[model samples]
Target: MSVTISFNNVIKKYNDKPVISGLSLDIKKGEFFTLLGPSGCGKTTLLRMVAGFNSIEGGEITFDDKVMNRITPQHRNIGMVFQNYAIFPNLSVKNNVAFGLKNRKIPKDEIERRVDHILDVVQISQFKNSMPENLSGGQQQRIALARAIVMEPNVLLMDEPLSNLDAKLRVDMREAIKLIQHEVGITTVYVTHDQEEAMAVSDRIAVMNSGVIQQVGTPREIYQRPANIFVSNFIGRTNIVERSLKKVDNRQVLIMDENYQIDLDDITQYAEEIIKVSIRPEEFTISDTSEGMAGVIQHNVFLGINVHYTVQLSNGENVEVTEESTLGEPLEPGTEVKLLVNKEKINLFHYESEKNILEGDSYAK
Candidate 1:
């Protein structure tokens, strides 16, 4: 079963300090949407509100065009998988998965049939009789998922469900979750602080910060074109170049720093007072030629598949770059080198407002 979930102008607070403020979003039926942010950013609070764990202050929540504000959590038909994988330690896997159905007073034969079917879907049918303590962390997690899904809830909410497992296991488990979610086609809202995980699994991501959603977009869109300085800096590694803009010629502005000057042409409507420019690490290329910008190599780090080089620009700015190869003689510390900045790859932001004008007007607010 699937239904569209909507949070319209949602607000939540404790002691008058707003945890979630006028947050609005919509999760499509059978869509995998993620609420991603750091701790205290209100992602969990928003999720709890949807789960009916927390009360909404000044907004409305609806499911399938029905007002859910007064609905109890149980009656909401919402399934949730928490970080701890809450399962009865003493109960066997099969029993644990069947517990929810039993509580709902389902028929005995139908309960068994449904439990067996879900166990097979989770690939834990053989371990159904095994206690949770006897299973690996990943197995236990799967059991938790099986329990939630067996209820056939209209909406599934997962709160950092893979956080307890090891890194390798986390990756594997998410793949399983994605596959199972696809087969079940349940509308899902996943909450997490891990950007990579959100990007990997979500159909859309709402990046939250300071009790507000900074941006919402697909993984590629959010990564390639951030909404603001905070979004760019948080989503990936970027070198923020602080500079002032001066009109150099007709329809062109010169980006002037302490030791470098680059021409910026085809300025946008909001590019009147450029304060900062963000460039991704991969956008820089090191060479022997004295073109573009000049910098001194500070350090080189080799990570097998990629090489990270820290370069100190002539303007006393240090920037890190990731290269494809560390081969062919590395640049030692304090070595002078030239950097080629991909001008087209630069992201310009307003200084006073601290907003990326490239993202459009709605993003500025």
Candidate 2:
């Protein structure tokens, strides 16, 4: 059965230097949760803690309301898929998948039945007798997954399982993993440094940095409304530009530059003179008339589905804007354009704390 995982004020350290500090998260049963960040950001460290490979320095980790901090890896009943595709070189796919059951002295017929079922579920039954050396990278990963799930552990932990595959194979494998996880209904904690991969597969993601979680939300929420400047800049392409907010009489007015201004409606809490705002590339639209900020196109590239443009503003700052390629003809480099920014979608972050000032709930905190 699937189990809920919880981290209650968890802490980890190396030589008194805190790697993970006071982390708290609740992963629902049958949820595909991901820990995503750059290298040395402590995502792997947290995953190891759950696997019982690393000891928690402080706080507690629980499985279905049962504390698991003191449980050994072997006794925890957690299955792990690693980055290296840890399959024996000489063992056939079927044998590799049945190794765990054999070690546990399960009945011979039971091992055979479980192995065959899992091989078919992973769509690698055709290669059941093939050695690991004869399989492709993607196929080998499938074998590893089959081996892990055949034991029917309470939790499944995958550490960068697709990192070794080619780009196309990575995409295909992630889709396959997503499908298999749904069918099996296992509570999974996936670790990855790729944002696109995390966004594609996770029900909810915890973006990490320096051993701390930066934000936790669904993929759309993290992409559209980031909790801080670090999250905005890390998840996708965003143009972070400096803007000024002024109290014009009673209402707050945002000055993009001397050329463009927006009147805030109910957002009266912002009183800072200068604020940093994150505007996504796809948030801007080209206008026929001078309705908004005016800029000159510096460069344009055709990306088949979308046309990417770099616009130089009056302040000499470059802003990126992407539009549907089928909208109209692509703008040339030297062309002048009026760009309209979507006011409602723009995110304002405090200059000092770097926390999002526009949103009421702060995920980082």
**Candidate number with greatest TM-score:** 2
Stretches of candidate 1 exceeding 4 Å from the true structure: 251-266, 270-272, 326-329, 359-365
Q: Write the per-residue lDDT of candidate 1 for residues 1-365, one digit (tens) a residue.
A: 99999989988989988888888888899999999988889898888989999988889999989988879998999999999998999899999999999998999999999999999999999997898989999999999999999999999999999988999999999889988998999999999898889888988999999989999998877877788888888887899887667754455464544455666544646434647888899888886675657888899987777788999887788999877874566668988888877666677778877777653322223
Q: Which ten residues in a row have the lowest lDDT in candidate 1?
A: 356-365
Alpha-carbon runs more than 4 Å astray in model 2: 360-365
So what's the TM-score on candidate 1? 0.92
Using all chains and alpha carbons, the TM-scores for the candidates as numbered come to: 0.92, 0.95
TM-score of 2: 0.95
- Model 2: lowest-lDDT 10 consecutive positions: 356-365
lDDT of each: 0.85, 0.92
